[model samples]
Target: MRTRPTTATAAAAALTATAALLLTGCGGSDSEDSGKDKIAGADTGASASASPSLSSSDDGIERPEVSLPEGDNLIFAPETTGDAKADAVLKDNAEYLRSIDEAIGKQNPKSEAVAFYSKDSAYLGSVEWISGFVKDGVTVTGTVRYFDRKVSFSKDGSAGLVYCADESKGYTKDVKTGKVNVTEASKDSYVLYNDRLRKNDKGVWQTTKSTSDRGSEVCQP
Candidate 1:
């Protein structure tokens, strides 16, 4: 039997890449889906601390607008940050994962999973890989590497997390031999997940999911 242990290491490294992974979104048609998703809603006016107003989403990444729908979803998000939320979320999540990297070894899967999420690894789990997306009047298409991630804002506006697969490169795991083999010829798709939060009650966002990338894919909803 092969005792190659890189799978665990790779998995751990993947946990760190949660921020980079959660950007994937399932494909949708122009008729069914619009350029922007309507904000669910929030009562942040209650706080008097509002996010700065932005002009446009011409920077490449789409700026999700937060507006009070007819009810709750919209109230929570009057405006969306210009990639600020996604960037900050990724950065904070990376920091949190680094802090616990050595702490959460292979021995702890469930605990490590939670640790990863608490650190804000966005949508690092429950992903399906397909390819491409539409953003900001621009259809910046991409070949779905390995999977897709879902993004959402928390109810309190203090937290937001993602659940996506992290298919960084191409490789395979010979479980019978316990070997995580790699090769340039290996381009078949496999899904992984990365969940990250913007803010947590504990003060810092972290990973939320990513048990395994064995089976998951991007879904259209």
Candidate 2:
């Protein structure tokens, strides 16, 4: 049976175009039935040190104003667990994933990958894989929305978080020639990611392991 693509490594490759598997952008009009969502609300002017802002989402939630590179539009909505520990894990997880996505979109994987990934071979090795994409001049352009995140803490000071990603608007293109390889949207376009994380001495959550399941029906939520 196929292995990596059946899990998170394949999911990462599909989103970033590193696993040698190309995913066509899943383009469709937004519908409530689709369960596809957009992040809402703006930063509440809380100090940057304030993480896991448990502010209730409302009609006045202003979208954070940040410059997104063209062809890359990833929107991360706020976490609303009201549980500090859970919020901390989710917050760090979102930032870590965003850092990697931005690095790939900007073609600067080296610096970004090193910053989030652990020194362990599995996680760090993924960075090496991503570096190859940068070396090949691949640029990812599209939108991936992450949702339905759940965090479980372990007694060993480690944690695991699972989330679903909708990659309906992302694709890989060649930077030099502006050539793009697009494919028909498949079940694989919808994915679920399981990430294993541990905080280092610096209080930073580092990705120790990750896996993905493509076309996971559970992720549709």
Candidate 3:
């Protein structure tokens, strides 16, 4: 099991879990954050114990206190099913990532992913959803990873939905170069305050203002 921090205050697990968000291919490999260069023959299969608290907890990282938001936000519950709309969104995101990998020339593609969302917040693998994941000028063509939907929140659902998305992703140019079997991962698990769903002026379900990001600047080209 790979665990990474939500931020600077959170650093229990290493960056391997989020690697899929940061990857491509066809395996149950987890994704990462930093220290990838040091990973050699790292086994990234599923962990025997699966707990969201443990999964999201990156022990030792500093957890700074922050103020909660006051506004209508979407939250997820335990039995949320997939709809034609949401599934399309998720599939599109997968395609978008393939383009990024092509740009970087990644090899040995593999990933496992999930998505979750609500009227207010959207989650990508237990992380807060944000717009603009990619850096400027990248012209990303698909959506990012979508996590599974959560039906219940222990608290007020201040955070968004939960996800176990495929954040693993990275690449190297030459196959002959000596390298460690390090995985790549990245994600910000938290909350996006005061998110709202907006409709286009024509009254269509335009994706510009969904609580979950359809696209934005979270990643770089």
Which candidate number would show the highest TM-score if scored against the true structure? 2
Candidate 1 lDDT by residue in tens digits, 155-216: 44433343332223323333234344443322223333433233444233444332443333
Better of 2 and 3 by lDDT: 2
Q: Could you say which candidate leads in lDDT?
A: 2
TM of each candidate vs. truth:
0.31, 0.63, 0.24
Candidate 2 local lDDT, 110-190, one digit each (tens):
543335434343345455555766898876667777776666666556766666677766677787898765656667777
Which runs in model 2 stand beyond 4 Å of their true positions? 1-68
Of 2 and 3, the candidate ahead on TM-score is: 2
Question: In model 3, how large is the Cα lDDT of residue 169?
Answer: 31
Report residue 79 deviation for candidate 3 (angstroms): 16
Off-target runs (Cα >4 Å) in candidate 3 are 1-82, 106-162, 166-221
Give candidate 1's whole-model lDDT: 0.30
Model 3: per-residue lDDT, tens digit, 172-194?
A: 22234433234444343222211
Q: What value of lDDT does candidate 2 attain over all alpha carbons?
A: 0.52
For model 3, what is the error of residue 147's alpha carbon versus the real structure, in angstroms, after optimal superposition? 4.6
Query: How much does candidate 3 score in TM-score?
Result: 0.24
Residue 37 deviation, candidate 1, in Å? 27
